[model samples]
Target chain A: MTDEKDFLSGYDPGDFPAFAVTADVVLLTMRAGRLCVLLIERGGPPFKGMWAFPGGFVKLDENLDQAASRELQEETGISGIDLTQFASYGDPDRDPRMRVVTVSYLAVVPDLPSPQASTDAAKARFWPVDDVEGTLAFDHDRILGDALSHLRTVVEYSPLAASFCEREFTVADLRRVYESIWGVDLDPSNFQRKVLGIDDFLVPTDRQSSSSAGGGRPARLYRLGKVSELRPPILPPD
Target chain B: MTDEKDFLSGYDPGDFPAFAVTADVVLLTMRAGRLCVLLIERGGPPFKGMWAFPGGFVKLDENLDQAASRELQEETGISGIDLTQFASYGDPDRDPRMRVVTVSYLAVVPDLPSPQASTDAAKARFWPVDDVEGTLAFDHDRILGDALSHLRTVVEYSPLAASFCEREFTVADLRRVYESIWGVDLDPSNFQRKVLGIDDFLVPTDRQSSSSAGGGRPARLYRLGKVSELRPPILPPD
Candidate 1:
């Protein structure tokens, strides 16, 4: 073959462009009735004092998912939660230093303790999507937008949205998750009917609870049912 | 930074691992009312004589899409067809010679002339998805399965399945595309109603055609309409 990196030829594995692979996380949670992403302030020279998503180069010996978990644990002291990759950004020029292809994941959690910034980050904090003012480091702004769109698409058709709620949750908690992320006001009756209608959408349990703030009617507790996808899928607001 | 490839340092771009990026295509069409993919037999070492998806390493300059189009043109003499990437596969062991991550695209066309194999391929032909016997070279079997799953998922919620039909087609043509790809027997009446019910799923034109096999009533002609997505999506068979 004319090229040295040919799959047929026993060429040096290092002949590849060797683009540094990185994982950028769009860690989201419903904070104060809004969707927030965990971000960091760069403490290093390239983008000193600038904000960016918590991410790092993928290690040579690990899978991209493993690299993501490792980066989260190393940078934000947050791990063990589910992280679904939504998109991979690799516009040759996306990274200034070299050809860096970053796979971005969207993570929605029920609770998160205050993060302790490590590695090259000076500080770490959760920034509400709307309140995330100013520019983000590299192409993180576009990556965040892509992740949010993917999240919106995923929540509309998949059961992963329930992962944002407590193990035992009322319908209100599920409704709130959709409302917060979708930024819409869904009629509760219609939403519940649509969710329950999906085959195995939710499994009703014996546990019940009422809001601590007021003694409202006791709500049924349910777990994420056997269904991984919704049918007559949830349509986005027109 | 302790690591040489650290993004924070604004270091030399050359220090990154520079893994090779490639693109594979899953070109599908309806032949005798069955969905088939275009594949090639490798003529060179390492998987020589094995059937594989048409692909090549990305050039130093062109984007992934460009590279895919170029490869298809070079190997099969097919060009200008719209090919959308469905998934990207990257595992260190996926490729034997080097770490090559591939973005796989899926293209659906109404008809295709016999392929002219060039480059490293010894032969090229269309293989029905249901009849693809033996193992495909590399990780293509998994990639094709992923693309088919994605295609099934897309047709349920989007109108892209019409891409497999001629520019002007009848309702039966559109129905066959879905049925062939999904491997389901959709009720004609139900399929027609569901398709027409979706807002702007089809735009009727003045053209008409009758089946050559029988002297049947002429069927009305229609084209892809403005609606990009289907609400209350068409669910798959149980």
Candidate 2:
């Protein structure tokens, strides 16, 4: 056996540990009345070839938001999507070889598109919330859970739920976004009143859906309103 | 003259790149009639002897919350307070020595005795939200601003505001917590209807205040309800 002191002395650096900081993107979009997130394949060692959230090591000079935006654009080939910082993760064993802390961001896109891998990855694809079956790399499973909870909470008081809808969507369309994410069937009449009553929550548009799935007087389409308050806040399911 | 390789090779043994992580405590409590935060004095190097939010380094194998709690307990003799992870800060140059990432926590307490110094060379004290006069050390001022905004948003929908009041309180007393934090006078009738209509926001108690400040009937006292939802959420001032 090798001498213990020799081995220990060889490994000792005697300085404060260096940690690699990175940003991960949880780009969310509504697809088929469900929430979907973009996932990327890792090409590098240390969880190589496993599905992971889109992210990269933050550069020395970039801010956290800028790093997140850059990673999103590079990994997903999408730009100009509104991204909000969600949470940060820093478990010592999160990365096996090094200490890595990742700041997670939530991006709500208007439409779902096939993602192209741009950085250190094998491939990029959009996975439906229902289809995210297996374990995700790193501590991403926890991060996604936190992001979803934040999204549901935000939708109650803020107009962010509208971001998941198209430029001009009917009230029913808006309600679907809430119902799917919250996993609750809303009272149609009450939902209509609650959404329309909020001034900034939606804005009436001079547009209507070409496809009349719910036959009647063609439903009038409205965009996200300018008013922010949802007078009577939307309560989550008991 | 030192060569490039030699210059790089002369890494200081004491100056190893340490993962600089900070713990910021959003110590919140109701003072007089408004919400306030606790601040502390720094007695260590690298901003030695400056006033800052009470926090410290994250030990290996500990989660961020554990670190925050440990710091809170060490700095102040307080323990078992309800604390929530609020946000994380990871600016490259937030610390002078190296890149420091901070996980900030929001803690709610019901008027405890003043905090005593427990860890580091620091003194702990409480300050009102409106009285954060000048710049705080290490971008703490920005962190405080974000924490306040989060508190405002959280109090509107969550049952957190009641944490500031006693176990049993009046509708008027609860309303004052909102008014004090938001810094605006609320219409008693509208406020009462909004809070009472919500199921379980507050529970009716058989006890009433024995002495009224003025004439009129002694208003009924009620304990915080089991239900957490503030149905028609109390909105912040425009």
Q: Top model by lDDT, which number?
A: 1
Deviation in Å, model 2, residue A106 alpha carbon: 0.7
Pairs clashing within candidate 1:
A17-B18, A18-B17, A18-B18, A18-B19, A19-B18, A19-B19
Reference-based lDDT, residue B23, model 2: 62
Chain A TM-score by candidate, in order: 0.87, 0.86
TM-score, prediction 2: 0.82
Candidate 1's displacement at residue A30, Å, is 1.2
Model 1 chain A: lowest-lDDT 10 consecutive positions: A1-10
* TM-scores of all candidate predictions against the true structure: 0.90, 0.82
How many residue pairs clash (N, CA or C atoms closer than 3 angstroms) in each of the candidate models, in the order given?
6, 11
lDDT of 1 by residue, A1-238 (tens): 2442234444554654555677778888777677888887776666677778877776666767887887777776678888877667677666666666777787878756445444454577888887774478788888888878878888888887898787888888889888987888989899888888888988899989766576777889998888877775777677
lDDT of 2 by residue, A121-151 (tens): 3466778876774567778888888999899
